[model samples]
Target chain A: MKRLKKVGLIAVVCLSLVACQGGVPKEALELSPESLQQRQTQTRRFDTNNEAKLLTSGAQVLQDLGFTVEDSETKLGMIAASKDRDATETGQVVGAILLAILTKQAQAIDDKQKISVSLITRPISAKETLVRVTFQRVVWNTRGQVSKTEPLDDPKLYQDFFAKLSESVFLTANEI
Target chain B: MTNTVKKTACAALVVLLLAGCQTDSRDQVLATSESQVALRSIQSRVFDTTDKAKTQRTIIATLQDLGFVIDKADATLGTVSATKLNGYAMRMTVSVRDHGTKQTLVRASAQYNQTAIEDPLPYQQFFTALEKAMFLTAHDAD
Candidate 1:
């Protein structure tokens, strides 16, 4: 009986303690941009070769497909160009040019992830360009097997990831 | 004798009640702290990709298509750093790392508040949308 009484007493004490605490902490779940930037700066090591390789390969591919490759050497994975003289016709031609490249690359990757290749042309206040057709390619890779997959095994995922990157810049260069 | 005994019992009861309340509060706080830790563990797993570089490349492409030039971009285990071009009102960043290796898929979410967002410009929007798109890419959009 005495032991039972002691245990009961302990239980009561525990409950009382819980009722006194305050609300959530001010910075409990929030992240500041600075912290984010710091973390990235600390971790992200840039490889000029990686960026350069991708850019060169992309430009070469674009030229092989017959689109004029402006700025053979682009900095920081960016390429820009003025709009083609025959805007819509040129856009269609570029899209077709990209389609052939994408089809071949997608087959090579044998990827199962969904690839979203979007083309949007937002006006640059330069001229009669209704929309600047900027291309983007994305693959979900839900299995999250990107870094895990070898360049040979899931070449499509890697290829697609870079395909859009290269093509997006490819189009931008035309617009510049 | 009876009045004195009653007063002592009442005082003792108050002391016991207060102590019980204190213990309860302590346990709750401890439990909450533990849960928060667990949540963070889960969140980190959101970025558990075998290759973060490949993931970032795909996301960057999508962002470019959406008309936002990536300003500052980086990637790690389950996280990405990116800024939209022209200083658009949206910023896109996400952590795809989560804790559990084989159990829960999402590791950590940098864009938890963006689960409900529909905009295509923000990183969250692009991230989630890309997730859906990735599913299709992986499956070959049959």
Candidate 2:
């Protein structure tokens, strides 16, 4: 019983220390060697200097993808948008139900997520404009607590968006 | 041993009971343990450029390169804010202003998981990355 008490006391102190385990991660602001590769994945160049029109098309593409243009600055060639969507999957829901049945405890499944994106256009020169977009998301569980926060780094997602953006740029150019 | 156990139990109970009445919460708003001058020296850098727009764009590009999603940007104000979510949320803001006739001052501040980052190491690393993008050396600003 004395040993149990001592172990419990140590556990409490350890829990307190664990609660304080936050400092800025050393690599959080440091540029990793993959910086150039990540930049290439997030950026694309277009052969246009009509930056204002290009930004407009970028916003349109975001809207087409179910995002609300929360803010924009044509002078800076930037657009900020976000969308909230259901995050539940049938497989996870079924698994959660089975677990609840076995343990008689409620399991929190991912309830919803908000995806935010930033689209920026840099006019490298009069002939070339670099359009870069970055995406991140926050997922909340049914218990109303954050479950995940991550950046969207999928290359296919970027490729699809750029394909749509190219079509939007062409359509906007022709007033279609 | 019994006395010590009793004391520990009492202390744990007190902590559990007092968790809801944290006095630190009141001071969290606009609270910093570091002095203004010290934080200024840590977070600000100067570069030999007076073009505010280009400076802001470079900041944006650097932030994007670092896996941050640009949150907001203004050319006239020369400010950019970005957020990076990699299982944790970190938000950063960078501002540019003409420091003098021949130099521009850039300042950056960041918050990680809702806690302000006051350490100089992160700021130094950030400036190093910014230097790479700007192709100009970063000189600490007073």
Worst 10 residues of 1 chain B by lDDT: B112-121
Q: What is the TM-score of chain A alone in each candidate?
A: 0.22, 0.86
Displacement of residue B33 (Cα, Å) in model 1 is 16
**lDDT per residue as tens, model 2, A92-117:** 99999999999999999999999999
* Residue-by-residue lDDT tens digits, candidate 1, B28-88: 4334333555444433323334444445444544444333333333343433333222211
Q: fnat, candidate 1? A: 0.03
Backbone clash total, candidate 1: 71
- The segments of candidate 1 whose C-alpha lies over 4 angstroms from its true place after superposition are A1-51, A54-176, B1-49, B75-79, B85-88, B98-127, B136-142
List, residue by residue over B76-131, the lDDT tens digit for candidate 2: 88889999999899999999998979999999999999678888998999999999
Superposition TM-score, candidate 2 onto the true structure: 0.89
- After superposing candidate 2, which stretches have Cα over 4 Å from the reference? A1-21, A171-176, B1-24
